[model samples]
Target: MVAAADAQNYAQKLGIIHGLVVQELGWDEDTNDDLRAEIEETIGSELLDEDSDEVMDVVLLWWRDGDGDLVDALMEVTGQLSDEGFVWVLTPKTGNSGHVDPSEIAESAPPAGFTQTSAISLGEWAGSRLVQPKAPSKQR
Candidate 1:
């Protein structure tokens, strides 16, 4: 297992590390596990458990759906973010099985009550940071 500092390093490069982070597993790979561990270290505790039912500040959405699954992904977790919270949808960069196009993300965002803010490049995936503008003040 990678050390906490390494995880934190990767997460920091990705601009993560804010309040309670909700990790929604759309990919469920070993790399995501490392990222999760790093994020937990960054925030100094275990992340919010999926069944916790609490508002989160940052959502690490690891998705591996190629074409048809983004809808389900967005629909299910869009409502889970606090008003000021943000969701980082990490998908395959391009060559991977579940690579999502940026245009596809733009088209799918608004209906889910999220705004696609920026694109991120990760070790093996691309990330789209989405935010719900109308959510209430966040806890962290």
Candidate 2:
């Protein structure tokens, strides 16, 4: 979990992005509560929990190394994203107990129909934005 100012900074980051925010905030209770309260107050956007009819503009996913079965998780989330929507995969930073290697994200995201658009450091978390892969254009 991040400290108060770190939480504030994280909240500020999420605030800049516009749209419905779907969160699969899979952190343990401690950080989860902090982040939830922070983002909710700062972002002030509608959030969805499980899958339903609606698609969201942004998805915030909290991931950890060895949490279990990433392929399955990716498959599940891919359908939740709108055509232009993006997913931010937040993982613990290196040296943290549950940190996930960036190389693994680079390798796995594409196989699940996503492309890693950018990487960001979100206070205590390492964030990567994954988006729908661009289709190859037809030959003229």
Candidate 3:
């Protein structure tokens, strides 16, 4: 059994904290319930559903191979973020059913207006953090 302290550490690694609006997308039976619970606990509320129109501070997107066109999915979620928000793309780890190639995520993000910022192992799921590239400064 995973310790609660360890699980909380994992949630913290995703930058989740109290009062942030975290939206969840693509949840299925295969997604990690423990991790989801930890995130909800850290945020002090349940994750907002995909249909929520409120802008989000973080988007937790669960994806898999054969799910859909990742580019489109990323673009759609990007539109729902607050200016400084980001998305965490979680996919099944290697050897698991529905596992996605990391290269596929790397390629898909740029066209959707995001860049891969970091990646971390989340037990059965691997997480990639994506953020929109900062707009270039305007010269006076």
Q: Which candidate should be chosen as best, given TM-score against the real structure?
A: 3
lDDT for each residue of candidate 2 in 64-138, tens digit (9 for 90 to 100)? 887776656776877767777777788888887789999888887877888888888776778888888767879
lDDT against the true structure, per candidate, is 0.70, 0.70, 0.93
Question: Which regions of candidate 1 fall more than 4 Å away from where they truly are?
Answer: 1-8, 66-68, 134-140
Most accurate candidate by lDDT: 3
Model 1 Cα lDDT, one tens digit per residue, 17-57 = 55555655554543456666777777777776567677777
Per-residue CA lDDT of model 3 for 1-140, tens digit only, reads: 35576444667889987899999999999999989998998888999997799999999999999999999999999778999999999999999999999999999999999999999999999999999988888999
- Model 2, position 52, has a per-residue lDDT of 50
Work out the TM-score per prediction.
Answer: 0.75, 0.75, 0.92
Off by over 4 Å in 3: 1-8
**Candidate 1, after superposition: displacement of residue 91 in Å?**
0.2
Residue 92 of model 2: what lDDT? 84
Between prediction 2 and prediction 3, the one with superior lDDT is 3
For model 1, state the Cα shift of residue 13 in Å.
3.7
Kindly provide the TM-score of model 3 when superposed on the true structure, using C-alpha atoms: 0.92
